[model samples]
Target: MTEDNGGWIVFQRRFDGSTDFYRNWTAYTNGFGDIDAEFYLGNQIIFEITKDENVELRVDLVDKTGESGYAKYSYFSISGPEDFYRLYVNGYSGNAGDSLMYHSGQRFTTFDEDNDLLASNNCAEMYHGAWWYQSCHHSNLNGEYGNDDYGSGPNWYHWRGHYYALNSTRMMIRVRRY
Candidate 1:
């Protein structure tokens, strides 16, 4: 990741939704200075930026084949001459149901209900509701350890991950100097 004129940071993410190969994406900032891009996908990549102090960027992926796989998400935090931005990347597996949360600092912006939110003004909120709820393993008892509410109703809270349990959650935070 590189910084442009002012304090803009640019990063990229590989776009290979249909294929199996790991594609490599690139990001570049403009001369004016600003966070050019945070997360890039599809033909037209999207960028999320914020001026706040606390915000988050949420991402959800859907796998139709039911095959277990993993993907990588990357971001670059750029700043001015005195301070430099950092690159943060994490690996997320493509399961039936998986949710990944990233905290882009309090100064960043947050995503809204729609997945097509903008990150330039504040933090952009990107949600994969269709994919997130459909892919994971759900139970009525919220996927609790010894709860008998298994399969009783829709398990909207329970999520399968390393922690294991109904409260299993994932979050990422990216700090950039502005």
Candidate 2:
């Protein structure tokens, strides 16, 4: 949660490569890892929380060089399992750049579930992580921790290149104020 900013609940956090984000669909649906270290707070829970509210999504990122940036969306939400938990994010405002907008309306994809737009490829299997991939992605937060080999690493492409590994990342959400 934020101390000075709004009450943001951090649902996804990664650092130190303690937890593996390259997981199957079930693992992503139910979520995995400890909240204090690294974790993804289940897609189901996220859908439940954001479905009825005008929520804001914030992604804070720190590169390997210690440079920090953030991406904030005024309206963010996702659909249920029937829809593959399709992403819906808009009203971008932040320093990290609007990388997520490219994925808006895209369905989430895991190694076991090929819901991405690319018909000939499994983005999750190729990228080493699951995400709301639109022909792959512009941001890959849930990826190979601290390893950029084969373009598999936690990265926000608008902030850093695809081959650069990030130092830390956090995805948070809160009810929009106005």
Candidate 3:
């Protein structure tokens, strides 16, 4: 419900058996904040928690499937942060091929044209044309080099300007607090 230091977001829900079965309540982050925690109910009214102790957000899904279909269950969760976390599906009981697909965690930060092309301990830089030695430095771009041409680098870059020029091979850079 709140964003503290732009760090965390929380969501919660409770059911008092006021609605009918077969209804579903889905939640999504809208690509705004990182997910810190989660919980859900099993078919047999079991309580389940899905999140590490130190996450930033928590989601809970209470499955109150009354005399409905065969309790068909499906859920999806994702996070965007600096580090990576393991993905668990179907109570971590199903095989990888049978369970839903999970993607690697992504970290995103605002593009700083002044810092994008400059090399630093956290970023790398590459040139598209001419191989200008000064342009190859990391700290020059301030971490915002999207192209190889002049007037502020390319229109699209990735991995902190590690790659350049090619349409599809651009790097996908992300930012996170140190």
Candidate 4:
């Protein structure tokens, strides 16, 4: 888990996600500056979106050079815990149904809906982050886990490392800051 100078758990589940969490977030979404500026390659990225948060992470694809919300139709499989309440503490509040939605199509309620209410809906980079449900596991999948490769070399996140291809989307990660 990535912690702030205050020693609070700011990010986790993956190092790359905790490392570049805010940099890639605002860089692609252009949400906040002071919050985004706080994060360095090794520092934790902190943002104040709500008093009670349990955000869900979204992994998708986008152009190498583009803004947020540019996902392709290609299917990919990701694993996560099916139960979020397991991670909850006192006052840790959020939707109870998000754990199941994380494995299927989006809820389409505005930008982010039932699935991951706070999902970035973009493709920034790998191991992208969001306030996932307390139970979303990284490997023990509860739903579909897609496996497709558009590039060669090594394997990661179930896809070959091909970040961008013309208008075609490249594999990337994004966090849904609540």
Report the number of clashing residue pairs per model: 20, 0, 26, 15
The most accurate candidate by TM-score is 2
Candidate 3: Cα lDDT at 91: 20
lDDT of 4: 0.23
Candidate 1 lDDT over residue span 55-74, tens digit each: 22332222223322322233
The true-versus-predicted C-alpha distance at residue 42 of model 2, in Å, is 0.6
Q: Is candidate 1 or candidate 3 better by lDDT?
A: 1
Rank candidates, lDDT, best first.
2, 1, 4, 3
- 27-109: candidate 3 lDDT, tens digit per residue: 11121112232212221111112332222222222112321111101332323222211222222221112211211122211
Q: Which portions of model 1 show Cα errors greater than 4 Å?
A: 1-48, 64-84, 87-178
The best-first sequence of candidates by TM-score reads 2, 1, 4, 3
Tens-place lDDT digits, model 4, residues 1-178: 1311121232222211222222332232232223232222211122222113343333222222533231221222232223211121122112211222332432111112123433444211222232222222121111111222231111121222322222122122223232
What candidate 4 gets wrong by more than 4 Å, as runs, is 1-34, 38-62, 70-100, 103-178
lDDT of 2 by residue, 12-57 (tens): 9997998999999988889899988999999998999899999999
What TM-scores do the predictions have?
0.22, 0.97, 0.16, 0.19
Return whichever of 1 and 2 wins on TM-score.
2
Best candidate (score: lDDT): 2
Candidate 4: lDDT of 37? Answer: 27
Q: What count of clashes does model 1 give?
A: 20
